[model samples]
Target: VAGQAAANQVFNSAFWVTSFLPAVTATLIAKEKAQGNEDGVQDAVCQAIFVGVFIALVTTALCFAKPNQILSSVLSQDAPAMEYARPYLLVRTFAFVPSLISLVGFSAFRGVL
Candidate 1:
């Protein structure tokens, strides 16, 4: 759903967000099991946000705001795909905010350990 110029942003963002969850969970569980630091909430949250906000504001915003007409310009004359892309992209864009909160919260959860 991301355009050419925004590819790296999307890729990097996806990398961080995806990799973060498992890593955080694993680290948190390990730290808890080992009775490690429980005061890293701010740092963890800041890190998660550092990774997410750029992609959310730039790439996701573009996808949501791109015109339905632009689909014709960007994609081949595939009517069915365009029809679905529009709404799906919009939905994903709109959901990005809340989803981000949840994801960041999950990351923060790890910090509590």
Candidate 2:
């Protein structure tokens, strides 16, 4: 339970960005397309992809560096499962970038279509 909770915390931290990136990407691309600017649409997609990947990478690195701190905060310092949660959280962090980027890509596609 503690391990799963900790993993959720780490992913949730990045999830907020995921929730909003789509809106930003979709809006930018839609606006550009409405104006008939293919270059601007491409630029918007690229920028959103870059930002999403960058944020995910940074989040993963931070989780890797401070898994204990994250677990402690989410599971409480006295939580007995902190030790177990640490590894679980680290493992889960690896998926952050890929998931985020995939969502961003979908958003871009939705925008284009």
Candidate 3:
């Protein structure tokens, strides 16, 4: 039970890192559109995607490199939950880039609307 709780907390916290992407995407689109540069909007979207992927990659690398430390900081070092949560967190980190890209896409669509 403790392990599950810890895992859930870790999972939820990690998602916070991706939460800013939508706002960023929307801002980028709006900026480009206001400047009357449709091409620039597309370019900005591409750049945003690249940036998101890069950040995810860095995050993944860090998580992999220091899973124990991260888990400990988030929970207790000896928490049974850390065992379950660490692997889940590592696996989830891989989804960040793709998820962020999708978010950016949605944001772009929202901007259009």
* Best prediction by lDDT: 2
Q: Which sections of candidate 2 miss by over 4 Å?
A: none
Model 1 Cα shift for residue 12 (angstroms): 15
Backbone clash pairs in model 3 (N, Cα, C under 3 Å; residues 3+ apart or in different chains), count = 1
Across 1-113, the per-residue lDDT of candidate 3 in tens digits comes to 56556655665677577788788888878888988999989897888788778877777787788877877766878876778877777787677677777878898887655
Ordered from best to worst TM-score, the candidate numbers read 2, 3, 1
How would you encode candidate 1's per-residue C-alpha lDDT over 1-113 as one tens digit per residue?
34432333333443355555546644654455456544454454565666566656765656656635445455454555565556655554565655666676775665455
| Cα shift from native, residue 70, model 1 (Å) | 9.9
Cα RMSD of all models vs. native, in order, equals 6.8, 1.5, 2.1
lDDT, model 3, position 25: 83
Of 2 and 3, the candidate ahead on TM-score is 2
- Selected candidate, larger lDDT, 1 vs 2: 2
Compute the lDDT of residue 111 as modeled in candidate 1.
Answer: 45
